[model samples]
Target: MAPQGMTEAALTGFRQQLTGDALTSGDPGYDEARAVHNAMIDRRPAVIAQCETEADVARSIRFGRENDLEIAVRGGGHSVAGMSLSDGGIVVDLRRMHTVIINPESRAARVGGGATMSHLDRATQPYDLATTGGRASTTGVGGFTLGGGSGWLERKFGLACDNLLAVELVTADGSTVHASEDENQELFWALHGGGGNFGVATAITLKLHELPAMSMIMLLFRPDSGPEVLRAYRDFVESAPDEVGGGCIYLTGPPEEFVPEDLVGKLVCAVLITYAGTESEARMVAAPMLELAHAAEMIAELPYAELQCMLDDPAGMRNYWSAEYLDALPDKAVDAFCARSSTMIVPSGTQHVLFPLGGAAADGPAHYPLPWRGSPWVVHPFGTWESPADDERGKKWVRDVRADVQPWSNGAVYLNFIGQEGDERVVAGVGGDNYARLAAVKAQYDPDNVFRLNHNIKPA
Candidate 1:
């Protein structure tokens, strides 16, 4: 099954139309092709094929299946666990397939699976419309949606997967099909939260929302003040309307133009407040954050797209991440955040963020494919490091901190923020009966578990 002896001749007919690069085991570009975002993952994929079109994607899947080669699908290649590449397998590099088509009348955008947050935001901003996306601009739309996307707009609109209208997928058997409410509805449901177990998505059609340009009140304070800030954040998040959502980021202050020179590189808590309202209305809502601590750069009235990139630039950083839903921000949990902030963060945007999961979107039952919804917030530890020697230290810091807050949480992890955890972790992400139901659905669509490469849902 290892494709070691497979020759270039096997894929000759399919190779003619490829405008992108295809490197085999001994090809000069093989190592570089297999190298994903994380340097820690050094997989020697049998073939790394960067595709330029949907046809190219179909071809790659066909070649891999014919040769019994395992498959890894790479969009923006940001998987912390490096699931984007497989050892001695084939990686369908869709990064070159970036395209965006907006239907203003339908309020929808048909996005190439390879597109990033930047692509979606840039396209939708002109129409004063957007949808749920990751905090960073570099994360891929494909992986994010497949894992149940959540963002600042989530509390307003809904989960990224919830807004998904349709998906064009090339399954394990190398057949292309469309997934939507009208057709293949079951498969569509699974892809919303099923990870990559069923197929490789070539394109996604997402529903957009009318959005208002708003304000950003970024507050920073000493680590000692983190507890009070979290409490303030809790009160605001619990009461704020769907028009608002801002996360609490506890981090080591960066030596940036905005941060005070004295506090640069020092441990601090950053409360990033974002709301879809005018300066006056936004300020009234942001009063909670101001009460928590001293304001750093509390500016308002910006373009929606600019405000979308308020967090650090997502590229070039080693992100070892995980997330969980919290029932409430208990005083003890707040203290735990403060304690972790005192020393754990690495310099340059290293932090822990508590993203608000409240809004009209969160007010739902198990109606959609996604599960965990009762929790009002999600706690995430985004561990960043500079050197390989420090990777374990950073991972352990996040792991320990996450464990410390576990008892106070709802025992469910948000799929989008999950990295390289086990099947048990994925099941926990769906919560209670949702996993069993998902398993039954998986049995129907992907019975052989040919798509076991992702946060897998084994067939019942």
Candidate 2:
């Protein structure tokens, strides 16, 4: 049912104002339009406004407000919590507005709000320039950056928000606003790891860096060797240069040629060492891991954009993910991290990942709301399965991983990596002081909390 204030005539008028198109219950593509990345989320928004221009976004917000409809913003439709959709409300779908404009001379890319990582990366790859983006190419650049984006390149270039130069947003009242270092400075600060609480980001400009080459060395071992491999990985990354990045993961080996038939469809400890340099240089840097006994190996130099899509988890899977920032990864923590992998739903897309964080990521701006940036390591249990029957088991395994690492946890987390845990986790993700400051910004821009679907910062 439509909201009390909304009527058929009002919706018809709203559709007429949109340059794109409005999708309602009876619309031909309503079901397809409401489908997000996670198959578990099945929300049915009363209306989905596919915005083509900044003007369309503003008009959608106004229509939602006028009709007292809860507003949900959709970018890449990758919010695991389904924050991009609202039941019987309004969704401002930005997928149609994907337009990436790259300026090679300035080393910058201006991306439309709804653009995915592929859109941004493909545009910049031609110029040999790139920015830190989400690990998945399908992730929305707006949500990823605003939530403190992390990726394979983060150790070298820093988090996505660190590369953010400017943003153009549509506020709750349907007014346009621009944020940058010298303009709307407060709002700009809030955008750094504050999530999408301020407004609907119509567009964002990111600072890019030149990259001539990229290489990776992936090695897989028996799961029993996980502890030793993880311990060695922790020590290796501690001294590795900013250009060196990747993670130690426990996963069901895929049916790739490099993976032995025996290891495929079974748990294996995999270590991937990525370098922003040649294959020879990567081999030299990853020598320690290479010496380990491994069942499979794949070493090659590839384009950064191509590498970004290598680990893309298939869509339409039941997804549940959580993360923890660790102050240290001692041998005991490594043991605990590996031990929990036994509970994981294997032969599936689930990943028990341990990412080393340092280099430029730690050295980025200190005043931003992202308190987890300085943590030396992050343990992410990304759970994805095909069956609803495994939901309880998948969720429990993720929670257990968090519990196992709590002793070394810094209490700060990355919001983009987790689902709706609770309000306290929100405070922990963005610092207590930072949350208070962000609430003030929220009060100014969205006093009514119209954009409350994300990691919400309540208005002051």
Candidate 3:
């Protein structure tokens, strides 16, 4: 079947010009093609173009514009707002284009736009080279890095965007463009954290660093010890070397063999200490937290790729997440953060997390739009559940946490960690000055705002 609004002849012509498959409403895998990471989003696009190459992406974009249909870009289908899918529109699905090429000599990797963190990490692990990536292994590298990527290694190596070496994109007019420090420098700056508002990234090249050994210390404690434990964790992180990174979190104890039977399915306070070194060094650095009483402990040195998948959330679950960056984590602020855990929906996959920033991330390029990089700490409330009945409650809990932390908020947000809040929040994520400059770039590359599904930067 042809697309809903497109004529049969036009649809056939577009399909013939592509080296990929195009699916319509009644196509064999139409339903599967439209599915994204967040189950809460249920949009049906008029056509789904599974692009296999950069040329396919250009053709799909041109086809969508010619047919007067909204165009959505899909990379791992992980946008929390379901921006990857659109109702009665055209979706450029890039999952088929996922490919990673590693260059050990230059310590760099060129990743396909649709590749996931797992794809990037697994490819680089063999070479003992790695870069910053999202906390989840299944997150799209394009969306995550462009939206100011943050991860367990951010403090040590800076954000994923900081590692960006170059990008190959398909513009609004279906023209190919490349951006790097020496070529298309303005577009290169915007791509750091400006997001998909600029264009469709076909591939991105990232700088990698040698990571010989990585270790982690995970300690689970009773909820009552949250205040003291969080305070200690904060102090330890403040004085620790940049090689140390992790977070203090409140989560439902899992059924893993390491967790005690009694704590399973119950709320617990946990502190995860990640060290970019061997197990012996990690143990010595995390000794402060080890001295405290804990119900369960897991300490070992593992491959970086292995650690990236340890907390992977299963797909198809309802997800709503928000974040607040803080200039400080004072005692009172820590108390407020822990107090909100009482309202969290227990026995679920939700996590109330506090991540420390301010190492290499703060020292990175200041010209980029990521204003949140300067923040010393961040509180991210990740709400994931399996039922629609708890949607309202789960969303409310996330909002309540944001409100509780407002007293210390730095007013900067990481766009990747949030859904569609509003336009003002978009301005706050990127500084007011940076937003204007990004708008200018948008006008030059996408004057009509063809790519507006993301944290939109309207043409000037």
Q: Which candidate has the top score in lDDT?
A: 3
Overall local distance difference test of candidate 3: 0.93
User: Which portions of model 1 show Cα errors greater than 4 Å?
Assistant: 1-3, 11-14, 17-19, 25-32, 291-295
Q: Could you estimate the TM-score for every candidate? A: 0.93, 0.99, 0.99
Model 2 Cα shift for residue 141 (angstroms): 0.4
- Residue pairs with backbone overlap in model 3: none
lDDT of 2 at 136: 84
Model 3 TM: 0.99
lDDT of all predictions? 0.78, 0.92, 0.93
User: What's the C-alpha lDDT at position 281 in model 2?
Assistant: 94
Q: State residue 30's C-alpha deviation in candidate 3, in Å.
A: 1.3
Candidate 2 accuracy as TM-score: 0.99
Residues 94-182, candidate 2: write the lDDT tens digits: 99989999989899999999899999988998888888988888999999999999888999999999999999999999999999999
Clashing pairs in 2: none
Q: In model 2, what is the error at residue 66, expressed in angstroms?
A: 0.6
Candidate 2 lDDT (Cα, whole model)? 0.92
Q: What number of clashing residue pairs does each candidate have, in the order they appear?
A: 0, 0, 0
lDDT of 3 at 285: 82
